[model samples]
Target chain A: MAGPKYVLEVENVHRIYESAAGYTHAIRGVTLRVPRGEFLCIMGPSGSGKSTLMNILGGLDRPTAGVYKLEGVSTSELDDDELAELRARRLGFVFQRYNLLPRATVLRNVMMPLIYTNVPVAERELRAYKALRVVGLPEEYYDHRSNELSGGQMQRVAIARALVNDPALILADEPTGALDSATSELVMELFAKLSEQGKTIVVITHDPDTSSWGDRTVHIRDGRLFTEEEERALIEAAMRSGADINARRGHT
Target chain B: MRPGDLAQETWSALSANKGRSALTILGIVIGIGAVITMTSIIGGISNSMAGMFGANAARVLTINLHGISNFTLDDVAELAKNIPDVEYTMPKAQIQHEATYEKTKVQATIHGEVNKVFEAHGYKLLQGSGFTEEDEKRGSREIILDQYSVRNLFGNTDAAVVGKSLKIGNDEYMIIGVADKVNTFSMTQYDSQSIEGIVPITTAITRLTGNPNITSIEAMTSATSDADAVAAQTKEYLSRRYKLQDSKEEGATRTVSVESNKQLMQQVTSMTSSFQAIMVTVSGISLLVGGIGIMNMMLTNVTERIREIGLRKALGAKRFDITSQFILESICLCLTGGFIGVVLGLLGSFALCGIVGAGLAAAVTGSADPVLPVIDPGAILNAVLTCVITGLIFGWYPARRAAKLDPVESLNHQ
Candidate 1:
């Protein structure tokens, strides 16, 4: 792998949020590269702006000023329709809340992405079934409604929905944040298995343990990515300032 | 999206909020149903009224000369020639007489009339033919018998008696035909002679009256003729022509009053039109309210499904697709309501027809058999089309609002 093909790339991205409190720089001059098949984790405390960067990477939001290339296609140059097309075909997203439609059957929820895709109508259900099977959901659960499922099972169905389109990169924003440790471990094991199968995955979380599951971890704080030493120093200063550093981390 | 797929998606969306959808649809159903019911009832009433007065009766004018015993066939013909749009004119005279046919004698009416009077009065012939123009010219003694005269002579109406001679006072006359039973509410005479017999004007003037005097003259204006204006013209003409004989008292004058069916028919028409207008307005208000309800419900649908909208957009739905989905959903609801309305309207119309028909028949004919509803397929089609258009119009704003929502914002909606 002398010349690694980058599945995602972001350069000098900046995001500014304006409220009644005036402008807050959510992301400042952040540059990062995600190589193919690399399981990467972004670690940050509350208000560290990691979520903003994740949103940019997921194509759900655009940086106020920056260039983002998902699979070498510059996202900033694309319009809404094209961006939607890119999200539908080349990238997958998993949210902390398991954004499956509660009223839909598990199978129907998983097949949603296929509705927008150019895939033949007949192949959509079969693809959805395969994705559900890969997420370790039994065939019997495929017909059940999302609202009927436990928290862990819902997350699995969400993951299955993401994989149904077979995108090159999967972005997980705290995929197991709402799950118990045992279920979290099961989810991380699934991510590990996906990594073994040569799928590039980027997960955003504040848990060092969760980050450890990735091949590499990057810490972000105060609207910028920092070195490990710099991150440790920031935490020490936050502790001294009574910012509750213990609670900053998802797990102690 | 394919229409079938869109329909399937809409169905799914509606079923999720079943109560709201049903209620919204019900509003439309009630509105459309009421419109059909009113249309049917009004249609029936107009039909019955038209049946009672013969079709051309709307243009017929009755001229009665007071203190003057006679006007003649020549007088009516001269009126037709002088009046600008007057289509034709006929003469009629009536008196009571003791009619004896083949030994049976009955006091009955004897009318001096022509063939045109039969059509103007909607009198259908039951036996033999009517008197012709030649009969009037040759002063033929042919007569058309009425039901009363037929029963008096034969004890029951018999077709064989049509060719026989019947004596009225002293002269014996050959019966030419018999007429169907008719409603004679304002048909000039109500005595026993009013419907019992009809004879040529020539025969009446020469044999019955021994003079060229007619009781009244009937003038039928042409279709394009303004009955009101022509009526005024006829009245003016009659007043100008009928000279008063010098009365024994001062300030006494002879004037012929001209009465046209135009005024009576216009009154009936205007009354019914007013009723139709009021009922239509009520139905229109209900439909308008129904549309507003749809708008309210569709807006709520958009608000509640923000996350779903975002998800669909992320999944590859365009702005147009999202708009199409919401609009299709509303249209589906309205169309369902419309279908139900049409069915309910049909049932209500049938029921209304039965009730009205039974009441009319019992009051008039003493029977209870039901009459079929007056179904105008064109009206039904218009109602259906109106509902579809209503759905499209009412659903537009809400669907547009849903489409205009930012995808990023909606996806993040909790």
Candidate 2:
């Protein structure tokens, strides 16, 4: 599973939300580690803490109790600026809704993250175009607005935006949750291609078929790690066991 | 963001909502236009008045006796001769005389004045000659009529009446010349009687007229630059020489009234200034309202562009950059409004001037003709500055709110 080295190590991570009403514990202690260039899927039901964990890993949220290290820099110890720097340099994100700016063209949407970097506009545009080209969108589609694109095309633009910064890790949340089966296959194929290019990817999804796109699948229920397995064996077992008898069901 | 980019962005945003932007700017346009137009019109009126009074009319002084007292012509002559700065002192004997030119009779003011009085004042001989020293010495039958009098008697021809004989009462006199029209400053006292004719003091002494006592002495001085001061000094000297007392404080009073046209002009100017100030203030309110409109619109824009802000922030825009962008956009809006307002206001002022009868070319210093809008750089600067400040003051809150947004929350927003 390892090529270069471990890129992320998470140990005993816990997160709690406090309000006037009371405290809601979003994540219990959880531990995991991933080697470089591995495609790992975290499968969970709604409210099973996968999103919170993803947010922490992406440097968008802080864990209440945890030790998180990316290349030996402690995530919990960094300030806002440092966390932003980490996100900017190390992580790329793909949200479920695509999140393409309504007013911007596909190229401009891809260049959005590059605005935070010290990249010149020319270089940024070049990189954005390259990223879009990787997602199979032609140069002519670069000037097309987000609203003008189909659901799959919009998702692809979002993907191009995620990859434009050339981050070390990609975090995708329900990447094909909104797509039809055929479009979902196309997106999965894109993920498989990205993984083949040695880009480390983590996708959080409830669908086992989507999880099958990963090299390895990790299951979580009730804010606890349930199991981990090779993707091929997980898919084979899911097919034989039938959807109703799957252990991951009704656990969240 | 770079300033150029900011400007381009602002322009695009404004262009996108042309109707709203145009309407907002219209408020500013009307305000600036009104201010400039009103000021130009008032200025034009004042200038015309000044010109009508003669270029040096602003310096003319008039002296009068306070009340009916025993002040003699001898005393008046003595004062005129004794004053070191006095250029010409003439006794004014007012009398009503009827002129009969072939039984077409016209009533006129027969002013008895000294020989040199016409020249010392701004009188120009339109034809022939003025009263001579011989006429003052012998009290002969010679007179000078104003242009209007000549026009009325001879039917608008200046050459027809000069050198002709006209009978006033029982005496026949040769009209030596026609005097230029008197420039009257008092708007209320404009009439034909104000411009009748002038005759030699000797002729008045021989003809049917008033008492030998001079009603008032008309004095002209070479101190045209300081006419007010010269008039004041002459009044003071005459007061002492004649033992004149202040009528308000004295048990007895004279009919003398000493005044300077220059002082009157000063009062008029001050009044005009106050009027102009009020107009400028009223117009300023529209500019202010326009600024507020820009602020409100920008705030709305900020709210609508929250996702864009989040995207920008995520892309590496600093808080200051976002704030500057919004503020610049607002200023652009307001300045655009100001420029339109100024142009319209000028046009309005010119339109108003055309409606009024005053000569259009009179240059009023601080005021413009109602028909010609005056463009003052100071006003434009003030307006633009107001707009920029409005942008800052009003844009700050929204910009801060945008800058403070949680990037993740914003991105997650549906």
Which residue pairs does candidate 1 place in steric collision? Answer: B109-B193
Tell me the tens digit of each residue's lDDT in model 2 across B1-414.
Answer: 445555655665667678877776666677766766776666666665554555655545577776555656577778767876766666777677777777677776777877665544556677778776787878778888777677667766355677788888888888887766422322112243333677887678557564565656666666534777777788788777777776566576653566777787787788878988888888778767766776677777777777667656554456666777777676676677667766776677677777653344323321122323345667657656765676677667766776677766766665
- Candidate 2 docking band: acceptable
**Least lDDT summed over 10 consecutive residues: which range in candidate 1 chain A?**
A243-252
Worst 10 residues of 2 chain B by lDDT: B182-191
Candidate with top lDDT is 1
Q: Give DockQ: model 2.
A: 0.24
RMSD for each model, in Å, please? 6.3, 6.4
Tell me how large the interface RMSD of candidate 1 is. Answer: 1.7
Error of 1 at B201 (Å): 4.6
Q: How close is candidate 2 to the true structure, as a TM-score?
A: 0.73
* Tens digits of per-residue lDDT for model 1, B10-63: 888999999989998888899888888887767766665655567787888887
Name the regions of candidate 1 deviating beyond 4 angstroms.
A1-4, A227-252, B53-90, B94-111, B115-211, B214-274, B358-372
Q: What lDDT score goes with residue A225 in model 2?
A: 64
